[model samples]
Target: MSNTIDREKRLHNRTSFLSNIARQLGRTQPLTQVERPALRHTCQNEVMATFSQDQLKDELVRYTETSLGAKAVVTTKADLEATLKQLCLDYCKDQQGNAAAGETIVSATAALLEMVSPQSLETDEHKVHVWDAAAGFDANIKIAERAKVGIVLAEEALAESGTMVLYSQANQGRAVSLLPEASIFVVAKSNLKPRLTQATALLHQKASQGERIPSCVNFISGPSSTADIELIKVVGVHGPVFATYVVIDDM
Candidate 1:
């Protein structure tokens, strides 16, 4: 086995290094868990504080369509399944006019499954794969890679930026969104927030209550794009090329 010294031992002057920093900062010793300052100037919370939930959703729809170049649709809980199926079919349409040419993979969240069971979405013409944790990583990822559209339930939707907040868990993995050609994010109106400020507040509250925070949090807005190559804008260079957000107003 190769030998590589531990970082702690390699930089053994840890205490003295901190003490010097503390002295430079006019403190006798390094402050231990000092309370954060309460006063701060920020307009994040006040940006859309006056908008109603419907207004916020409208703003998200407009912003996503115009600025982010993504499709956004508002639907009711009763018609969610039909909306989802039609959207998946459109995305999976083949050159020969077949609607069921590609697979659709969905997250295994209980909320999503309750709304539209994957079994109901499946037909003789098409297949729908759920993020099955019991099948292990290899099996689930293989399906995701081949799937044309990935559907996931967002924990929260940010109105200002048209962003969908996703928290990774054992049942919901990031691969469902990253691997597919297109992604469909389903979010409820009640869970929609004004912006990132509210989303961060919820996470902070969870931390204060000593609840387990998610290890991976993703904020996705529209499709993957980058202008790094020759300063020319390009889409789908990093991940899925198409993105759509389906908002359930009644729920």
Candidate 2:
């Protein structure tokens, strides 16, 4: 009888606690959420200073070849998709990782494609990797044995130092960049700006609204680099040795 009574009391309290949830949330109905609107500003400075075909290729090359020492190529949507497919085929040829390389590439790249756009990349491949890219942590572990290049969709940038700020969340994983030999940034032009000062203020504005910042706030200017010994260059010590920024211009 004592145990029975105690169980009933615990059940009652659980129900009562659940009943108070709506009041705590100030909701008589389901909570509706809204996205923050995008802010737009023009490039007041010289476009050439920031935008140049030569610099674009050079920057990617510097990070890919020297820093990360990656032999990555920049191409159109079609080219990237095809390249990924070819990579999978190569991996599949010898049953690498017991997976078709095409599937591994497709599995990881698919999630990225969906985040960037649905109609953008061809998705009907219907192939899935043994791992999922959205599972950033798990994916990093699985890809641990091989060279990996992570691409983060940055929310903002500071032109003063050519620094890019990537917010870590469900889509942006800590290991996605940290575990890879080379990490790339797909900077949405919509997030680009001319100054870090302005970006810091925006951060404060969000904080004022009681929004907690992400777990990891990264501001990267270049690859994982160090100059400790005789000021000589050593890269990819802690993280990716090479870094690339593929700036997607906003209209």
Candidate 3:
């Protein structure tokens, strides 16, 4: 059949390409595998490796506020809903200081909704929408574009760079964080890691185990910013102008 001939031709081409590469490398054939060499330095993993969970949480807050120019708060699980509501209210206000004048979009993840239901925040002036999988892409994108604030639960928090890691899912679309004017990342204290090294190691482990990784993994470090325009630093150039981290303690 024509399909069978095409498949064989493609495979032959790929093998020929690899053979040429092998010849350039002074090998008769392509290598099946290569062993990893041990490095003389492991400082990347060693930094803050000994810090307790609480200590890491403190470092996360400190780095986020001082270096990243973002807001962060550590609160107990009992006060999480109230803390989130207050923060949302502060960010969703209009120019005239009308409370809840702007709309908000929240990821429909169980970890997030369980902490604070969107229904509790809904009002006549303020509309809170969840990432609705049933509504499909066009509907969700419209809601995210109009929302003033987008909120999602972070899978892990990196202490060194004040970064929040988000593993995209069906109910947690990438637009929920990218399209809004502001982003709220809620992370549990227990999930705070020391740095990006651990986060990458996690992915490596998953790959080794033949587990499917997320289609999109976002490492958001504070608000969107760039300094490329004439070397003058400008904030909120590409994405949300503001970012806030809400760390839930006693989780």
- Which candidate has the highest TM-score of all? 3
Candidate 3 structure, TM-score to reference: 0.86
Worst 10 residues of 1 by lDDT: 1-10
What TM-scores do the predictions have? 0.85, 0.52, 0.86
Roughly what TM-score does model 1 have, to 2 decimal places? 0.85
Error of 2 at 87 (Å): 11
lDDT of predicted model 2: 0.52
| Each candidate: RMSD | 7.0, 12.6, 5.5
lDDT of 2 by residue, 137-160 (tens): 655465642534445556775544
Poorest 10 consecutive residues by lDDT, candidate 2: 99-108
lDDT of 3: 0.89
For residues 98-197, write the lDDT of model 3, one tens digit per residue. 7757788999999788878887877677789999999999999999999899999999999999999999899899998889999999999999999999
Indicate the residue-level lDDT of 151 in model 1: 96
Screening candidate 3 with a backbone cut-off below 3 angstroms (N, C-alpha, C), the clashing residue pairs are: none
Where model 1 places Cα greater than 4 Å from the true spot, the runs are 1-32, 96-100
| Candidate 1 total steric clashes | 0
**In model 3, which regions exceed 4 Å deviation?**
1-31
Question: Ranking by TM-score, best first?
Answer: 3, 1, 2
Q: 1-251 in candidate 1: lDDT tens per residue? A: 01223334555777888889999888895558557687587787798999988999999999999988899989998999889988888888887767656798999999998999787776666689899999999999999999999999999999999999999988888999999999999999989899999999999877656566799899999899988889887989889999999999998
